[model samples]
Target chain A: MSGNPVERLGRGTTDLVVDLGGLARFAGRVVVAGSGRPWRLRRLLDEVFGIGVLSISIIGLSGLVVGLVLGLQGYNTLVRFGAENSLGAVVGLTLIRELGPVLTALLVAGRAGSAIAAEIGSMVVTEQLDGLRMMSVDPEDFVVAPKAMAMVISMPLLSALFITLGLFGGMVVAVGIVGGDAGIYLTSLESSVEFREDVLGSLVKALVFGVLVALIATWRGYTAEPNAAGVSAATTSTVVASSVSVLIFDFFITALWRV
Target chain B: MNVSPLRDLLVGCFVLAGLLSLAYLSVTLGGLSYRGPGGLQIHATFDEVGGLKPRAPVVIGGVKVGQIKSIQLDGDLRPRAVLDVDPAVGIPVDSSASILTSGVLGDQYIGIELGAEEDVLKGGDEIQYTQSAVILERLIGKVVQNLGADSE
Candidate 1:
């Protein structure tokens, strides 16, 4: 039984190595397909409308709710120490530095990443990609590039909107509901958050998460087996894989930010 | 397939809102500004700046007229702070600058009280009188020592 477990572990490691190789090759093809002439602006707009515009309400509402919760909890904790005045700085820094980008990416991964994978998976199952190839058209250029590019364009904007709403929500809870001094809250927030360091870092994190999610989703769909079950599996894996990688990369980015 | 104009317009609005929120975050909360070097520069030396830092506000009579541009150590190893004030706000040459905290544990800032001299302070001038930051620990220690001496 012990040897059996070791054998399974060895097989799993080999499979992971092989999958990583395939993913790298697929990513190279996508970059080549996306960067060339005929910028494909129309399809990109359609994808952006699908991915970004539709995701705004969820992103905004989640941001506000999270901010409110942070304010409430932060105030309760800080009041004990008589540091309730620093609530704004705490909420603002936490949102801009970490939660805003990470939450937005996770939301996008669940909402849009699954859809991209399923749509591409269905297209593959229906042999539409084969049809496009038969017509001397590249499916990667026509289908994958626009979706990936739209994700890259939308992520930072959505993250910014999320953070803005979060700050407003936090202010509502901290000042309006709790009766903290508005001037102190605002000044504390402004003083603590630096544009060059925290704001720019948040946007960069969002952008990197965008690239990671887009590549993983597209690659999964393109390589999925041509069947209904395969399409569902691809969608599920897209959500799971992208979410994991977004969090992992967030850790790495934050650790290396000052370096 | 051609997209509808209304849809494109919605997308445009979304993009605009995103950019607007980004601008708000960067400018208001992040304290970004495009002001050039149009302010009057003056210097003050202090024994201890305490929590005073660069970009701390410089106010007179509770009205802000400037900010600390930088903080450096002078040849005497004292903290020399450079203040950037609005050129429009004239200051007297004999004015005094003091480092004061906002509350018991809030951030520290520089407050200047105007002197009675007719001559307005000019650029690169130095404030004649200055007070250093009050350390809380030292104050408490002094109070304890005074009580001890009185009991003895």
Candidate 2:
């Protein structure tokens, strides 16, 4: 019976596909339940503080490092062509479009994604999720909505913070450290770029990534089996799924934008 | 029929609102760079785009005016990059396209250096000249190797 290859293959493929379908439905249900809750205001507060308010320091520090690195690297490249003035736009545009979104998603995946998986997985193992169902209360409203809403809301502000911090970080390295003229750099960058386009793409990516991360983590945790073993799996799955999902969506969005 | 569609409808609205937040953020963040009131698209081509990704900005004079819309290999096996520029900033046809790196280890994007030519490049115009991105690490290695040879 254990060596039944045909049965194993059939079961594995069926479960994989079915799991994905079930996950999609579960995600939809989460959104619905979250919205229908009377404590929507409270949920919003938790999301903002947990996802956005608390993440400021890390996001800021990362932005500073990236910006400084960009400045240092950019100076070397531009000095060769004698077009060193292009540094600000390079830093600004890159942060707005690619690094800002990618980094933020990664950070959130680690912090929030793992947390979601752990929270839900623990709940599942303890029978809390089932208890809610038994009591006719929607767990999605009480759980999923807060996390998802927080991500969607806080991502844009975080992106902007990343951009602003990066700009300053680059400023320190370029102007203060490298002796580049700050006024000239800003003027050139302002004349050449707009904040809206750069920020818009990041906002979009973050929002989507947030939702995806929430979905994956919550699903893995909520549907986990085998108790403690399931928690470990859920945690791993949440991080892996969030990271992979971000990269996949990044590719798709990039492709679509190009079109 | 006996149950309430009203409950389902309420749930739907909540979900919709959450979705809208995502969509709204995407649109706003994407438009943060050079954008006109009404969005517009422009096109450009390059021999080598390097590692340029989509949503990569179309910058002129170190200012982003658009984004790279698509990239494909031409009949000559050259990379042809399509750009989406804001309608407001008019690019002249004789403008030069160069693949420039943001820094030592950063993403590459095509830069349009506007020419002082009397006629401005309109929509569907091609940038006459192109320069591919110059990687700093490669350049530095070459410089160091040459110096080592001199010392030897």
Candidate 3:
């Protein structure tokens, strides 16, 4: 606290590097523990129920709303150039390739990501994790692995649902509301999107985001200080860090996909 | 976290919905269909394909019957396109396959002009009359040249 500016900057850099290394190690541990015998199907299912099933309403509603807005906006813009027929392609491609996975990840990071961090952080503060350790139950296997594994399993499914609902919403606006030909809308949408590129790429992106968000949330909670303030800080950090990493990783994934 | 039958049921439903949505996205919207060996496969060689791409629709009278299976080069080094046409559409052997743009700036597709021949095209048959894509710049240049000739 009393160090000069240069010393403080140096110390901060060291802490950042150390924290990154720690996070990576924690992620490896979770993967190893998750992949081990017995599979812990029950614990994983409970977490999936908490994380994936519970977040569906928010994800589905947001997807539909986003699609509606895209349809409205795309129609207005494309109509100027007499390209309103391509509105379906525009909305579909945008949602499938970019918005669907990214938005779902961000929403999940906010909803389930924060929940995971808070729950695990509070457990840390309350010495529940320690109690599990005392009982010779590796906390990583009993708790962390299931949560992390559930996030991975849930992400792509939730993303697919988001894209589907978004497409329906777009159709409702483009065909039902905007007076566009339903056949033309659907044809354009189907023709424009490719299976290998758009759909697979989207699932891959969602999967990557799932891994990142899960690792960040769990790692933050596991490494939090054993106090109430630490739990709060861990929860906040999980949200902020998960969101920023999702966006950054999204850019890289997109660039790599093109390659 | 304790596992309950109710919770398992809800999770099952969620997983099912998610998978159904994924299927819809992949099969319906993404156009991942079964490429059975059922269609009438025909070949057409073009001088220049322009912006024509694989999987572009093969249409007759503005109705899509099938699509372009693949675009490759022939022995003559020209762009040869394999078209997967519907078997029921008894297109004459003398029909021509022309690469046409959908709109002013839309995707390029193959348009078939049916001939008055009695014999229908079969699998692996070559389309004798094939028209290459209309390059916009070439069209503009021709117009500009025609105007110059008129002035002279």
Give the top-scoring candidate (TM-score).
3
How far is A137's C-alpha from truth in model 3 (Å)? 1.5
Residue B144 error for model 2, in Å? Answer: 38
lDDT of 3 at B7: 95
Once fitted onto the true fold, the runs of candidate 1 whose alpha carbons sit more than 4 angstroms away are: A1-11, B34-44, B69-76, B82-96, B114-129
DockQ of each model vs. true complex: 0.70, 0.07, 0.78
Of the two candidates 2 and 3, the one with more favorable TM-score, higher being better, is 3
The TM-score values for the models, in the order shown, are: 0.88, 0.62, 0.89
- Across A1-259, the per-residue lDDT of candidate 1 in tens digits comes to 2568889899889999999999998888888998997789889888999999999999999999999998999899999999999999999999999999999999999999999999999999999999999999899999999999999999999999999999888899988889988787888898788777898899899999999999999988998899999999999999999999999999998898841
TM-score of chain B of 2: 0.71
Residue A30, model 1, lDDT: 80
Error at A30, model 2, angstroms:
1.3
Candidate 2, residues A49-104: lDDT per residue as tens digits? Answer: 66676677788799899999999998899889887887887876777678887888
State the DockQ, from 0 to 1, for candidate 1: 0.70
DockQ head-to-head 2 vs 3, winner? 3
Query: Candidate 2 chain B, which ten residues in sequence have the lowest lDDT sum?
Result: B24-33
lDDT of 2 by residue, B29-129 (tens): 33443334454555556656667876676787787777776788878888787777777787666788888777655567778887787887666666778
Instruction: Give the alpha carbon lDDT tens digit for every residue of A133-206 in model 3.
Output: 99998899999999999999999999999998898899999878988887888989988988888999999999
lDDT (CA) per prediction: 0.91, 0.73, 0.91
Task: Provide the TM-score, chain A, model 2.
Answer: 0.91
User: TM-score for chain A of every candidate model?
Assistant: 0.95, 0.91, 0.97
